[model samples]
Target: MDGQENEEHANRGEDVPATDRAPRPAPRRDGAGRTGRRALRRTGVILAVLAVALVGVVLGVLAGGRVSTDIGPFQADLSVAPAFGGGTKVDIPPLGALLLDSHDGPTHLTVELGALDQSRTEALLDDPASINRASQSAVDDVREGVLRLGLRTLASAVLVTLLLALLVFRDTRRAAWAGALALVVTAGSLGTAAATIRPEAIEEPRYEGLLVNAPAIVGDARRIANDYTRYAEQLQRIVGNVSQLYTTVSSLPVYEPAPGTTRVLHVSDMHLNPTGWQLIRTVVEQFGIDVVIDTGDITDWGSEPEASYVGSIGLLKKPYVYIRGNHDSGRTAAAVARQPNAIVLSNTTTTVAGLTIAGIGDPRFTPDKNTSPAGSGLTQQTADQLIGVGDQLATTVRSSPRPVNIALVHDPASAGPLSGTCPLVLAGHTHDRQVSKLPEVPGKGPTQLMVQGSTGGAGLRGLEGEKPTPLTMTVLYFDKDKLLQAYDDITVGGTGQAQVNLERHVVEDPQAGVPAPVTPTPTR
Candidate 1:
């Protein structure tokens, strides 16, 4: 073949060996290939700019994120930061922060009350009307502080982004773009945080502090709205309580509990509220309680869904003796019994903390759905069932070889038949606390019927009323002989209020060698 034809054949790879074929000339770049290369370069530049802008914005935020302002009579600094869950944190320096689950977002705003203007505070205190003015101005002050913070943050972000972009890219256009992008991101973040903020969260703030008296200093929040009168009273009470708590806590003596004395915590009507469990746990630890006795109404419906609340029993870490209430069912009893530390009583007697106790579950099961206004208080049918249960409990107490130190039931009336069978009969169904000396019966000793209030603040139903009910629990001091010596009724004010009143009542147990009952005194 001719040379030209041979070259064409080689180009086509038709009749040539691999090594004998001439090397192909380098292929010229096409429009599409050039376009792809340009696009990749642009993409790389954009990514590099974005990463630089993000770092610049973060550094800017850290530099100029916080602003100081006067909120009422207090001086505070406000700041914003990235967080997994959005919330407002009020940091009272040297004390602790109060966290409020205010909204759902990616930003956490913090208000640190750094100092109190003593002169302003004193003047405001002297002139009550100044408080209203200060409170009204607080919102404006906070708004101004936030606006200033936002402006500073944006300026810093733009300046930093521009400098970084210029230094990295050595191009004015890229630096401008980076600055603009940073501005947009910072503004959007601030706007989103402000838009999602929930001011109502202050009604239920959670305290995170170093001091053990934090709970006493800042009472548990439930739900409070539109009750400014109560709010003012609560604020005053909180100030007073804080002072008292600090004094008591600071001067606490190194002492030991009485020898052979057993502290028993009596709690009732949890109503499936998790907060009640927290309160119980705190009280148990604070008072060094040996045993816990729950009268009834651990749940409102006693349904399967409510059964999970009973699991908190095992967390108590102390012997938790319980009896079913009118709102509880057999299933609830079984659930309580399933807990590791729970001892369910259904017309049965048991020994705990060196004392023989007998208890009976309420026979009635009046869930919220089945409840009526008339039926809320004891009805004829309910009374009859209670009496029967009480009789059965009394029989259990009598059958026991050891004398029953305490008898537990759900209703005060049920405790009537249990009189004289045991020295103390505890019951709780009427969401009110009362102590009654039952008439003497032909048996061992005079019975004291102690009815407990709602420990869960009557649960969610508590919010239905004009005012929420305070959560209440009692601590009973039993002597070595298992005789009651004294007791403290702990009452925690409901939402909008921050008062924890602990009143002590010394019982004159003739067996305990006491002459008469001392009048109740408010401890704190």
Candidate 2:
């Protein structure tokens, strides 16, 4: 009984000890909860600041007075400042620089920028890929830089607005509200002011100040830009007409001298007419021409700028033989040499398509200088100088092992001195088509002197007059033996009009046995 009692006592003792354990302290308020609340407040403050900054940036960009970028080849200056109400203004100086300075007097022209749609403007601002694919990255960089500048300006405005609000309101919450309200009001005012200004359907950006002294063509700049597409289409049509004309000439009986005769297309006095290229290309392809002979006056002034005009001749795939005229400057020869197919002849003979061709350039650099004898034709002084040049070339042609088959010159006076040296003598300064059998020289076959008319209808000079001169070109046929067989003369109406008339003349009938080859002799 005592042992059992002792066991119960031990159990009771342990239970008593457990009851003495201290009550768990009331659950301590979690410190993390306070920390979480504090963290949330900080996050809200940061977000609010970021939102305000974002708003300020956006507002600043919209209200920015002007944004400009110096894009390559052009300066894109956009003015958002209140102007003529609230319309945006874009000014580009380089846009007006494309005009050619081919006119006289002070030229004034205006172009409407609104002629382009919004999409075009956006494309131009963003990438300018349509105008030049290589400038896309540069354009994008410029746009971004302008936006960044606006952002910086907005940041400064926001800072100032916040300071002002704090000073006036004297309370943080009130200051924030005041600042936001002021920004809203300012943006609203700008928007309203902008709305008052309406954009013109066609707004010609003011370019007079920029172009007043620019050395460029003095024409209506606006018209050139607007009519650019029309000009391009006209060029295409000209090329097509050339192809058709060739087909027509091929079908003509007189154009074909024999089964395998060498056909030569003579073109001269182009005077910078862009149409001449297409015309030459078409004739070469259609007639299967063996060679092209240009007697000179390819350009009027033969200035450096006119060098680009000579590039058109490169389009012809056939061998092109050329000689400079009085109007063609020395620079013209340099440009002609750059052409892949051009062969510049200077008192030299070259064999082309089995025909010996010799040529001499004109002596005078400018044709206007010799106007003293314009009424009665070339003066004896000018004629003697031309004859001297012909004599010099005649010596070269007469000395060549291969008899010179054709002689090319620019002035008619030069043609007379080489009458018996070649069977066919070509000249073009007269700008009048003349084909005459030269008086037979004692011991030499009669030579046919052919003068080609102005291929460009006197070019831009013709526009100065009441009527433009007619465009003319000639096609000369040669037999297998390289003797002049027959020829066809083609004439077309003046600029802006297309009226082609062709006349065929038989120089030497093929059926009427080939005349003895002209014995080459030196001109006295």
Q: Compute each candidate's TM-score over C-alphas.
A: 0.52, 0.55
**Using TM-score as the measure, which candidate wins?**
2
Instruction: Report how far residue 25 has shifted in candidate 2, in Å.
Output: 73
lDDT of each: 0.76, 0.64
Worst 10 residues of 1 by lDDT: 246-255
Model 2, span 96-125: residue lDDT tens:
222222112211112122122445434443
For model 2, state the Cα shift of residue 316 in Å: 1.3
**Whole-structure CA lDDT of model 1:** 0.76
**Candidate 2: regions farther than 4 A off:** 1-254, 367-377, 509-524
User: Which segments of model 1 are wrong by more than 4 Å?
Assistant: 1-257, 369-377, 442-444, 510-524
Candidate 1 lDDT over residue span 28-126, tens digit each:
869889999999999998999899888888877777777888888888998877667878888874445788887666667789886679898667645
